[model samples]
Target: MDDKELIHQILQSNNGIIEARQASEAGINNKTLQRLHQSGDLERIEHGIYIDPNYIEDIYYITQLRCKQGIFSHETALYFHELTNRTPFQLQLTIPSGYNTRLIKDKERFRFFYIKKDLFEIGKINMVSPFGNPIRIYDKERTICDVLKKKDQLDADLVSSAIKQYIKEPGNDFSKLLTYAELFKIKDIVRQYLEVII
Candidate 1:
């Protein structure tokens, strides 16, 4: 019905966040947002992002929405999956090179690197609820393959350890590695590594 009412529905629908333009499409005017902020009904997470602070408290949802197809990977993804115990130096998200995205929310250790799209596979695994919704994580197979392909960020020890751990599983989906490898250009270094491992 009105801006505040529409915003209320958006908050409940999108876990407390919505793209700014959506407000307008729903009949919310800029003046309404200004009024809401004045009344402390909303807060800006970024230029075009806003949230009802109470409904959407977690910052990662905003970050995740920004990345879209991006899944936290490498050390960051590994830490989240509990596949490794390493402390991450930053929040790393693998995206296509030339990937344009909103400037990341201010914080420490925010890392964004471009990976070939083919490397994006190691898909979602069932993860425990975040803010009470069942979440899925980037699967281990895809993560390890991307790490191996990148190789720089993942230290020799960590890479080797992760590989060994991943390989040990009967359902590890090792073939997913090969299938995803076909997505890349088959560079000599990556191909050589895959040949040795798979």
Candidate 2:
């Protein structure tokens, strides 16, 4: 296909956004991007990130995309899974222990947690953020296990409230919770919480 056709195909597949690197891989040069920008066909949103003029901005997706290793976790994951009523001021992100995080620009807006590489991907799921854009997050089960494991360090009332709300939600998965608890080495604490609620 020709340059314009190829660029159009790439933009269509990428939810109306594309990076300069992605464009280059597809043989769409920077000059072409500049031309498109000059002609009002595309807009530069973040450094090398560009979007079709019609594309809606999604801050969550942008943040996740910019920091590819960041997996939403802790309180942020709780909110994303709808297990908590309070919105977190800072986003919580977890990355594998050895993953380089220099790509993340705005460190102030996020709180980072580093987990062993072996367990980093456990219970990971793709869910839409509040802004309706795709983001990676730990599932409710993993999130519950995390909060339970760190209960002593977190707000006791909030932790209890999240667990109580999670238990009342339909389709809650105890088996998955148990499995994640075992994996996180917090089976005893999780069991204590479950026994009280179940």
Candidate 3:
């Protein structure tokens, strides 16, 4: 296919977002991206991330794409689970230990947690961000365990409030929370919080 057609097909499949590598795979090159930008067909959002000029961006999806192994965690996970009302200024991502994040040039925008590879995928689930981009995040149960594990770094009031909110939220499963607590080794802390709230 020609450059324009290849770009069009990619844009259509990816909700209007395109990456440089994707273009390369389709036989389009860096010069073509620059040409498309100059011609007003595409807008570059980051170093290698681009989108159709008309597309409304899902910024977190772009972030997730940048950190391929990142799973939304901590405050960001709380927001996804609706256990907290405050939006996190910096997104939190958890990646497995030994994964190099140096390749992500814009790493300051995220706070990362490194878990052992064996534990990295625990309670990982896919959910749409507020902007409607699908992302990997910890389930509510695992989020609770995470926050409890890192409570020292979080505001006491915020931690208390999030646990209270989760306790009241319909469809929350205490059994799942308990299970994750075992994996996270924060069962006593989680139990204490739940006992106080429930």
Candidate 4:
């Protein structure tokens, strides 16, 4: 089948987001991408990424692009972990320190930050926002720890609420926090919340 037809199938399978590199695997070239765009078939989401413009929002595409092995993290993570009822106004994205994205047109709503790669490994899946933005939340232990790291922006009450909700869910991972806290030496703050809540 032709590139156009193949691309259609690939995007259809991916729920409308395709890696530009993946398309190249099917022998899609400049001419092919140009044709798709000219025909209004593909919309650029980020560098070397394309999505179906028809969809009001491309959740899978943007989520996959932002987190990767990185975690959704911080307050956003707490909400996703179901530890809070608050809906975040800004979407958070965490990457390994030094990770970068190409210039984006409307990045005002994105809050880009970084943590070590080892820190990112503890990230977990959270809910998607109404906009289809993935709120890739960090594990509870990790969320508390992150809050501690940014205590200036957070407080004991916020941390308390997150932990209280976390206990309500069967998703608590104390070991993950202890291990990370000890490894990073934030035990008293991030790891000690367990003592405060229970």
Q: Candidates ranked by lDDT, best first?
A: 3, 2, 4, 1
Which runs in model 4 stand beyond 4 Å of their true positions? 66-70, 103-107, 117-137, 154-158
lDDT of 3 by residue, 50-133 (tens): 889887887789878877899999889988887888888878888898897653455556788889999899999999876666
What lDDT does candidate 1 reach at residue 35?
74
RMSD of each: 4.3, 3.1, 2.4, 3.6
- Model 2, range 40-138, lDDT digits (tens) per residue? 988887677778878776667877877788898888888888888788887888898877765445567877788998999999999986556688999
Query: Which candidate tops lDDT?
Result: 3
Error of 4 at 144 (Å): 2.6
- TM per candidate comes to 0.71, 0.80, 0.87, 0.77
Candidate 2 versus the native: TM-score? Answer: 0.80
Clashing pairs in 3: none
Q: Candidate 4 — what's its lDDT?
A: 0.67
Candidate 1, overall lDDT? 0.66
Q: Write the per-residue lDDT of candidate 1 for residues 174-196, one digit (tens) a residue.
A: 56666655554334544575567
Report the error of model 4 at residue 14, Å: 0.6
Per-residue lDDT of 188 in model 4:
81
Q: List the residue pairs that clash in candidate 1.
A: 90-109, 91-109, 122-142
